[model samples]
Target: MGEKLKLYGFNNLTKALSFNIYDVCYAKTAREQKDYIDYIDEQYNAERLTGILTTLTDMIGATVLNIARQDYEPQGASVTLLIAEDSMLPRSQTQLAHLDKSHVTVHTYPEYHPETCIATFRVDIDVATCGEITPLSTLDYLIGSFDSDIITMDYRVRGFTRDVNGKKLFLDHPVTSIQDYINPEILRRYDAVDINVYAASLFHTRMMIKEPDLQNYLFKTDIYELPPLTRLEIMNNLRREMIEIFNGRNIY
Candidate 1:
């Protein structure tokens, strides 16, 4: 990296990354659907989500000041972490007012269609940081942390900080697209699209898995046990579901 910008006082620019990840599966029966939801709840409980957020905090060079997590009654989990930059003052000396300035959060939603026999698990994550840290650094890890079939991301830079010359700088770093931060190997597995507003310092990206393997979409069911026709139907339904989610519209 080049020399750090010479800020007049403190870097106040706020950078935020929002992610929506969906994992789709084919559950042949109502029992399987319930089982799928239970499995997801156990796999990504509040405790596990907290662990993931803790790792992310370290990766971005932030200190966790506080955390709040909960697992819903029927299904789902949520985790929130309040963090501060490493360069910030120690907890004893720091004030509690800025706690919301930098934080990381995650919430999960698991649901299914009784008619289609398709189940989807959605995880929403938000990472916002003030000062020198950037949430982009944790993109790869977040993607790999879940079974991401369809993913949508939004990144924005808000507020301004002053330089040594007393001039305001809206954005300290250059970001043409969120895809730039994603790993190349991961990019190969998905077809991606970008919608960016350069002047506003906002970026958006949507991705869908390029290849759909029947085995990967099957939940608690053996692919070998299904007949060829059944497998084909399941594959089509799975693809349709992904397409609808990717486009944010239903197909008639």
Candidate 2:
């Protein structure tokens, strides 16, 4: 019916913004199972990201997700997310392109790396600029860094709606993440960053980033805080909200 939306890796996302990410997608899991939750950070939130990270922690035993986020840098988890819309579908999260099979392949038996996104796309929007992202590898961040704390994140997002209703009410919610509501302490320090990456999905394949002002319009930058809010408080609040509004979603 229409063209496809595109997603790019942090490298492409940042490059579009005139910045560069040394290494992105830092998660707070174990080095062994680092492959599990690479994308779970402050920048992006998927359905069950934190839970997946906790599972990795339990498997890691005595490991933590916060440690995985900024384990390497002073600024902490240096990564950014870029999103684009106005494609074959509407401007909804569901309408956005995700990891697809045509883009990448992962072999779990050997070993996994979560430092990078899975797929990269070349995008052109209007006449402003050109951008890119890895729709595939970005998933690990969402699915991996659940309970982990990511200090810094920047992204460019663009959304289009297929149906006007989808843009008007289909995505509206009454609540915010506990961090969005209460005491949210971002990263105060940093150390070594550990990137345990994975593919966002088997299908999403490739995506793109717009350009120039379009990049500014679609892209965004955000920072996350840790402590004060208390992980327990965040979890309880998240759980309560999930029960009340999120239906079966892990993150609300």
lDDT of each: 0.89, 0.23
User: For each candidate, how many residue pairs have backbone atoms clashing (under 3 Å)?
Assistant: 0, 62
Question: Could you tell me how far off, in angstroms, the CA of residue 87 lies in candidate 2 after the best superposition?
Answer: 14
Residue 41 alpha-carbon offset, candidate 2, angstroms: 20
Question: Candidate 1's error at 70, in angstroms?
Answer: 0.7
Model 1 segments more than 4 A misplaced: 87-100
Please write out the lDDT profile of model 1 over residues 4-122, one tens digit for every residue. Answer: 66565456688999999999999979899999999999999999999999999999888899999999989999999998874543434432122235899999999999888999999
Candidate closest to the true structure, highest TM-score: 1
lDDT of 2 by residue, 30-92 (tens): 542333223222222221323343443233122231321112211112211122322233344
